[model samples]
Each structure stands twice: as C-alpha cells, then as structure tokens.
Target chain A: MLKQVLAAGLMSALVAATAQAQTPPILKMTVIATLSGPQASLGEQVRDGFALAVEQRGGKLGGLPVEVTVMDDELKPDVAVTKIRGLLESSHQDFVVGPVFSVVMAAIFKPVTSAGVFLISPNAGLSTFAGKACSKDLFVTSYQNDQPHSVSGEFATTQGYKRAFIIAPNYQAGRDALTGFKSRYKGEVVSEDYVPLNQMDMQSEIAKIAAAKPDVVFVFLPGGLGINFVKQYRQAGLTNIPVLSTFTVDESTLPAEGDAAIGFYSGTNWAPNMDTPANKAFVAAFEKKFNYVPATYAAQSFDTAMLIDSAVKAAGLDHDRLRTALEKADFASVRGSFKFGVNHYPIQDFYLAQVAKRPDGKLQTEIRSKVLTADVDPYAAECKMQ
Target chain B: MTLLVVQALNGFQLGMLLFLIAAGLTLVFGVMNFVNLAHGVQYMLGAYLGVMFARIAGGFWSGLILASLAAGAFGLVLERLIFRHLYARSELDQVLATFGVIITLNEGVRLVWGSAPLELPMPDALSHSFQLMDGLRYPVYRVALAVTGLVVAGLLALVVNGTRAGMLIRAGASNQEMVSALGVDIGRLFRMVFGVGAMLAGFAGVLAAPLVSVEPNMGDNLLILAFVVIVIGGTGSIRGAFLAALIVGLVDTLGRSMITDFAHAVLSGPASSRVGPALASMLIYLVMAAVLAVRPAGLFPLRS
Candidate 1:
C-alpha cells in the first residue's frame, strides 16, 4: 500500500514540475484607467486596446504567461492615487498602465514612479512630466499633450493664417494647447479665451469669435464640449471662417456633432483611414470586435501594449534593463514607425486630418496630409533623462 | 456697444430658460415639501422625446407638444407610484429617493438613447440667423426661445398668483393643514403641481433641444443652476424665481465675456488667458454667496 501511494504522488509531482519548468514567471501587470463617469469612453478605449493586444498574442505577451488586472479610477484624481497605490503594494506588478486624463495621471505620478513600476501611459501626456518631471520609470506611448496643438499651429502657419484666435477650457491641457499654438505660429493672436470645463453655453463666446473674425479659429474643447461648441458655432453662422482644433472633433465626437462637424480640421497622430497596414489591420479587428471606430486613445494604448511586449522580449523582466529597452522603442506603431524621445515620449509622424463622412455613412477622420514626417517634442531638450 | 447689446440679449434669453425650470421646481417644493432631485431628469427626458418625436412627426412643433405631454405624463405616473410615499417621509428620505431616481433615469436614458448626443434639427424656417449687428448675427430660433421663455414667465406669474388653483397652491405652501381642513383634494392638487412642474421643465428641454446637444444627464449642470435660481429667488415664489433667474442668467452670461476682456487688459496675455476663465466661471457663485449673505433666506424669501 505504501509503494502504490508513493507512485501516485511521484506521477503528480512530475506533472507539476514539468508545468513549472515550461512557464518561467507569470508576467503580472496592473492597469488603472478612468473607466467610469464622464471620462468612461476614453478609459474604455484604452481597455479594449490592451485587450486586443492580449488576444492577438494568444493570451500571452512576449511568449510569457501574463496576468492583467484592471481598476477603474472613477475619473477622480484622488481616487486614482489610492487605486495606483493599492495596485503597487498588493499586485506587486512592475508594469502599470493607464488613467487617461492628465489630472488623474498627475495625481498618481508620485505613487506610480516611487513604486518603481514602469508607468506606461496610454494617454494623458502632460508637459510637467515631458519636461521637468520626466522619470526613468515613466513612459508615454502617445505624444506629449502639446504636440498635437503644436503640429496644428505649424500647419496653420504653413497655410498662411496670419491672424489667429485660440479657445480652450481652463485646464492644464487647455493652457498647454494655447502655449503650443504660440510656439509655432508667428501671428497676431486676435483673442484667446478660456471657458470653464463644463461651460455648455458657448453662445456669447461664439459671438465674440464671430465678431473678432480671425483668419482661423483654434480650439481645444474635448469630449462633450467639442460637440456643443461645434454645433453652436454652426448655429451662430460662423462657418465662413476655418476652425482648427486638436482632440476636439474626432470619431467619438464627430457622430455627436452630426453635420456641423463636416469641414472641421485637426492635427492628429493616427486616423482609421491612414494608408498603413498596422493601422488598417488594427482598425479592422477593432471594428469587428467592438463594432465602433477606435479613437486616438485606443491607438496609443494598443501601441503601449505592443511596445511593452517587444520591450519585455528584448530586456526580460528586469526593471533597469526594461527601462533601457523602452527608451529604444523598436516596434511597429499603428501611426507608423515608433521611436521615443530621450524623455520616453513618442517622436512620430502627425497628420492633418479632417472630419469627413465615410462611405459607410458615419463621420470619421480622413487624413489630409502629413503635418510632419517625424516630430520631436519641444520639451525633449528639458528632459535630462541621461 | 453692439457686443453689449448682444450679451444682454444672451443673458435675457438664458434667464428665461432658467425661470421656466425654476417655476416648476419651486412650486413642487413649496406646496408639497418634496425635494425632487430627479426633476432634472424630466428636462432630459423632454429633450430626448423631442428628438425622437420631432424626427418621427417630421417637424419641430409636433415634437415639442408630444415631448411636453409625455414628460407631464411621466411625472404624474412617478408621483402616483413613488413620490406619493416620499411625501410623508422625512426630507432626507425624499432627497435620497429622488437622487436614486436621478441615477436610474440617467442610466436608463443612456441605454435607450446611447451615449452619443442626438441632433434635434430646428425647423428650416427658424434655422437662419438674422443680423443683430453688422458683425453679430443671432439665430432666429434663439430669439424664438427667448420670446417663448418670456411668454411662459408671464403665464406662470398669472397662474400662480391670480388664479384660484394658484391661490390654493399658495395656501398649501403657507399652511398645508389649513388647506386640507378646507376639504381641498390636496393629493389631486399634488398630482397637478408635479405634472405641471415636469411639463414646464420638459418644455424648456424641448425649446433648448435645438441649441444644445441632447444626451444623457444634459440637464445636470442646468439643474444646479435651476436650484440656485430658486434659492436666490426665494423658494415657492414664482415672482422671486423670475427675478432671480434673470439676475443669475445675466450675471452668468455677460460676466463670462466681460470678465475675460477685463482680465486680458489687466494681466499678462498668458496669465489672463488662464485667470480670465477661472474668475468668470466663479462670478455667478460669488454673486450667489453675496446674495445669500445679505438676504439670509434669499433675495425674496416666501412668507410661511
């Protein structure tokens, strides 16, 4: 009886040993996103992007067993700090992803970087981090928040728009937008007005814009504000002048704006109609899986996952080596050839995109022309990441 | 001068919309002592229904009527089923219950209408903009919105102060027991009050639908503004609501534009761009604080 029991135990032990030998170490990752409240759509896009990468890789990243834990930060900055801290302490993950809004990302910066986690930001690129606050542990898969606006400003200048007007919500991103516009455009700013983040009534502001009648109007109202502003602008009969904005009118908001958004122009890093295999494939699989167009948030997040996967392969799970591998961002991006600046933010191509109705009869972003072949951030010089 | 004229008209138009919402909110709270935080959902429902019906009936007028009727009916049904019980409950209970209703309705609307804002097209006749000044052209639809708002304010004043039903409502607001002792069907009156309040908010939603994006919780910020109007105007007083709403609206609209210009003139370009909006947004709240400090009760506190 003792011999028989020993044989059965031996067989099970062999099976366990073989399984352990095959799988080195489970790659554990914690993702924090603003998955609820006003910013839910943005968070959802990030989540899906990460999920798509995982699925395509046969549920593994870099050929290692992986576990992903996601937490919604509830669109609250303070709440994000707590969630990030909890994940760092409990999950013990060396890699962390997301929290889309700049405010939330800024709030959790200390905890995330302090914990030695590789903070892969899918969105929310702040100038603070891109410049003075840049950290070895921090990595952004998207442009520094100001770059889109900078590209648009440069595009505007190239188009010979002499007199310009800028409008944005009174927030960190908004200030950065205005600052970015000023960086490139050597023109007289006729008016630069900021409104409350939730200011719905743009009638008076629209009136002021009409009265000023700059050669072009630049705005940075994202989410619902974008839809409201565009519609109100149309209602005010201000369609004669060209409107330029970034993160304002896109696939997510274009549908909301209906016909009012038809002629709107914006600078972006990725659009569904980009003539690239990576973007085309990403869009097709995403539309098939989610039945909606992926926004810029999703594009960056997908890049983030792919970047991480490639980095892990190149550097293994070691923190210092991983950071080194990340700096050399060698991966095919949906927006095409990816390379990070010394600060760990992308220096990639940006396109001037216009809102146009798709052949499918839904409004989508159509790339008009290349804003730049490969753009480096203005803040990269300040990023002393050596 | 033209800018001033345009801004004043904008404020007046905004004020009228506030009064329409506050009229119903104040009357319901005044007589019934029911705190309905879900009142805002009625406004949202009105906009949603207007969009659906306007599309179906192929015009704006039919959409407005249908939305108003549907919203009033929805309010009446809710009163019969849920609010009737809360009337006898504690004030906190009423607030809590209504808050729950607000959450449920917001989610329900999102499920039904989707998160994308639906376009409610203005009738072609009213869609064009007319010259308010050489450079300033205002939409005829918006002018219609203001005129309709003014007319509604007048009708509300007449209904609440001069009419017999209005008198009963006033008596109930002042002394509910006395009205009940006089054999008034207070429950029936409660239904009427709730329905009318819902209808008025719905009407505003219908009117504002063409201008604003119609999405779930669109009434949320405006609801806060409506509450402020009632508080500043004096709860349960339509006259106070009208005056206060006008004050609140004018201050909110003109203050935003004027303050931005003033800040730009006083501060550095970038600094003013930052400070201008922050200060302008806070101006209304500052006014509310100042008004409350002086009045204690409100600008026109109702005599209980």
Candidate 2:
C-alpha cells in the first residue's frame, strides 16, 4: 500500500513531464547507482538528491518531459556494465547519471561513452580518467579523487607536520590518495600501511600507528573502513596525534562514528553547513524530504542534475550542443563556485572541515576555510582531451 | 619488541574470534556432514542482534546472553525448516542451498536495518584502556575480547571432553552411522550440534560488534577466513581449530604490519609500497597451501 501510494504520488508529480511528452514523447535520464547492499546509503542519497532536483523542476528538464529511471548495480561491476548497455540500447539520446564508487564506474566507462550516451558522474571522479584517459563525452560534477587529499596535504604542511604516516585500503583509489597526499606534503612519510579493501578490523595497524609516532596520520579509508578506523583510533589512545582524512568523516558515516568523529579534521569539496543560498536550499529541502542532512554524495548529485539541466536548456537532446553548453557551466552550483577543468572535471575550491556537535547534539561537518582556490586536479595537465 | 608484541596480541584476539565461529562450523560439518555456507550470516545476525538487544536491555551483558539465545533458537529453526531436508542430500546440494540462505538473510537484514552500519557501543566498564607497557596502551575492550576468547575455548574444551553429550558428539563426528545404530536419536543430536554451532558464531558476532562495524554482509569476508581456520585446524577437531585459528590470525595480522616495514628496510619506499600490499594479501593463502600440502586431512583429522 505504501509502495502504491509512492507510485501514485510519483505519477502525479510526473504529470507535467507527461503532458510535455506529447510534443516529442519523453526525454529519459537514467540514473545508475548502487541501490542495494552495504553501500546503498551512498546510492540512496544520489537517487533522492537527483529526484529532489527533478521534483523542484516539476519532473521536467529544460521545459521538456524528463523521465528519470534509477537502476541498481548492487555493487557488482558486471551488473553495472549490463545496466549501462541496457541504457545505451534503449535511452540512447538521454544523459546517464551516476554509478558511484570509482571501481564500479571504471568498469562501465568504455561501453557507456562509446555508445554515445552522455555520462555524468554524481560521485567518484576517478584520477585515471582525469589524466590521460580524458574523454570529451564524459563530465564529472564531482571533484577528482586526488583533490581532497592534495588540499588536505597542503593543510598538513601548513600546520608544520614533519612526520606523517599513510594508511588506506589496498585499492587503486587508495594508492592514488596516498600519492596525492605525498605530492603536496613535503614531510618524511615514516610508514605506509595498505590493508585489504574490505578489511574492517585494524587493531594491528592502529598499534603500528602508535608505535611509529608520526606527527600526523593521514588515512584514506572510505565507507565502513573509516568508521572502524575512527572508532578504534579513539580506543587506541591516539586521539592527540591529529588524524587527517578525506571521504571518511562525512554526514553518511558521521552519526555512526558518534563522539569518535568529533573534532576530526577532514578535507572535502562540499559541506552541509555551506552558507551559499543554493547549498542552504538543497540541505533544507533534503532535510524536509528525508529528515536527514545531505552528505557529499547527495550534494554532488544535486549539482550534477543542476549542471545537466543548464545544458538541456541551451540545447535539448542534441549531443554536440549539450557538450558545448556544459563547457559554459552556466548552472548555479551549491558549492558557491564551480568551473570546468581542461579535462571536463570540476575546477573548484577544496576546504578544510571539522566535525562539530550541533546545538541539537547531532554531529555535522562545519567548513573551516578554503584551503585551495580554483584547484584543478594535478592530472589535468596530462590530459589531451580528444 | 613492542611492535611485535602488540601485533601478536592483536593477532591472538582476532584468532579467538575466528575460533568461536570455526568451532561451531567444524562441529556441524563433522557430525552431520553438512557444509553450511550461511554460517557467516549467523555471525552477522549476532552482531545486529547484540546491537538491538543492548539498546533494549540497557546493558551489554544482558544483550550478549539474549543475542546468543536468539541466534541458537534461530539456528534450530533453520535446521528444522531447511537444513534437515538437505542432510540426506549431497554436499553440492547442501552448499547451494546454504548459499541461497546466505543471500536471502543478507538481503533480509539489509531490508530490516537499512544499508547503513549500526554502531554497537562499548560498555562503559570495558571501554577503558590498559597499559601494556611503559608507552604502549591497549584498549580494555580488546583485552576483554582476548580473555573471553580464552575462557570460552577452555569451557568448550571442558564440555566436549568431560560431558556425555561431548562423547556423543565426538562419536557422531567419527562415525554417525555407528552412533545411530547404537539406538541414539541421531536427529535430536544433529539439532543440538547445529543450534550450538549457530550460538557460537553469534557469540563471536556479539563480542565483535563493539570492535568491528556491524552491518549487513559484514560476515561475508570473515566467512572465507573462518573456513580457512577450520581447514587448517583440522575439521571436526576443536583443538585443531583453536591452534589453526591462532596461526592464521597471527600470520595475517603480523604479515600486514611487518611485511611493509621489512620491505622498506630492505628496499626503497616506492618499491616497498608496491611489494608490501601485494605480498600481505598473498601471505595467508601461502600458509593454507603449505598446510594442505603437508596434511591433506589437516593436522588433527578426527579418528573413525
């Protein structure tokens, strides 16, 4: 009954788009995300954020009937590839939004782009694509993977940390993060520990962190890995060492981390507490609809829709026109300011943020200050976009 | 010296958790000749249950007992409803069915809990830290885990060796047909073993909830490790599982920590970074391979 009510509500909401469809039928925008499994929260945020954008636009994009269909990859690469193929075959002219997680996105990159569907990533701006593999067909509304680490590393250096330790899940993104940090941090990296990607328990690694006694600990754990690390780090009696991380302490995992995440310094491109009008509206709308503060994934996804909407207005369903329109980046971003890099990824400000207790006793991130302004990803230089 | 000790202690704590799950698995496999792939979900459920019960009971200790009871009862229900039917089937059939069970339970838990991880708070009494050395301090929760693991192992050994039920279990594991031919109700015995195994796995989950992030599919990775532990420990032998769990845990924990440090000492930073992570993943599988090569039936195969 509830699902039926939701379906009926969705139908009523899509009435404007449906009526507008009489002219040209429907302009479909398929969102591919992990709608199931452990990382479903991230996917849920993207789906909801995108839906909110569409709802605000009254289920239409650029005065055209827009039908948004979300597919669940279920955290499987094969499933994601299949979904992309399905979308390419069916909705060939529309923009495909998201399939988060750098690894999953990397799997379907070639097929989706080759099929001539405009791929807009809501999250996971993989560095591999940002550099040499830059494609003219793809646009990332999100910051490149290395942006946070590089900016945070700059902050670490400014704070005068001479000794540093790096710990991250043993994955491609993990390697990229540590490399990005080292590129900016001119310090003696005392040790580097790369555990398995799925590893949750890290007492041994925590013990090693204490033993090494680095001036600062920079961790690259995302999802549950970050939660375990933060919780155990506090338990290990190393809270004074000042751990810095990216993609770790955000709204999605902050509540679960509870007191452990308080005062934890992180580097991010977006925060819920951003004072910009667009950001404030997005957060307020998200809270009203979902009864929870929007995380970076949701914020970036909303930005993706807003960006796509700008291009759709300039040129409806024309690939070349949309590409040209996107390059102009005429959309009002929730991040206050945004621009496109040579590689088509965001050239945006990265900021230092800290987890703070709200007046209501809930934990949320407060942006401290801008760390890097108009920072294009380091790999943008290597990209010769063909 | 300090680093090594800490790593060893960490390894031991992890091994104890592995043994808790392995103890029940080996018993089920040995006695009923049933391979339960869904066992890891049992552990996952235990963690979730611990969180739920703790929240309700307002104490971790009460939550622990309640979670174990709930897990054990759930296991028995599963055995009666599904597993008993598969006992007469081949291992391949049992494996497929249990794998299905794993998927269903994983999805069910996800539906109930929502994909976000549920945090189980550490009891205030066990939330303190203990000084291991002059400069090194270990979390009191971890010390409690290690101690509880040891105590559980001891109590398990005592029950399996000293009690009549233990003798029946050992007899059944060695030769189920002969034990049944002696006029014992093998059905009842099988139910007991299955329920106890589930309870043990759940207890591990409950203990581990405060340490690891409790979420749906949390047990999937550990399932592989627990299987390796029982295989190395010699299936059907609790003593073997205990020994093997310790070795597997120590090697895994210490390998991840020391291998890179050792590599860096011998090679350049970049070279060590490349070699260390790759080697750490392969380290445990290497041990398992060596063990299988040396003792195909494991180090302490149950006598028939």
**TM-score of each candidate?**
0.92, 0.94
Docking level for model 1: medium
Candidate 2 Cα errors over 4 Å, as ranges:
A1-21, A384-386, B134-136
Clashing residue pairs found in predicted model 2: none
| Candidate 1 displacement at residue B282 in angstroms | 3.1
Which residues of candidate 1, in runs, are more than 4 Å off?
Answer: A1-17, A21-25, A313-316, B52-62, B80-82, B88-93, B266-271, B289-300
Top-DockQ structure, candidate number: 2
Expressed as tens digits, the lDDT of each residue in A344-376 for candidate 1 is: 888889888998888888888889999887788
Give interface RMSD, every candidate, in order: 1.7, 1.5
Tens digits of per-residue lDDT for model 2, B1-304: 9889988999999998999999999889877889999999999999999999999998899899999999999999999999999999999999999999999999999888777777888999989898775445688888889888899889889988999999999999999999999999999999998999999999999999887788888889889998898888788889988999999889999998889878888888577888888898888889999999999878788962
lDDT of 1 by residue, B131-237 (tens): 78665568998888889988988887888889999999998898898899999998889899999999999999998887777877788888899999888888888
Tens digit of lDDT per residue, candidate 2, span A292-318?
A: 778899999999889888888988778
Per-residue error for B221 in candidate 1, Å, reads: 1.4
List of clashing residue pairs for candidate 1: none
Candidate 2 chain A, run of 10 with poorest lDDT: A86-95
TM-score of 2: 0.94
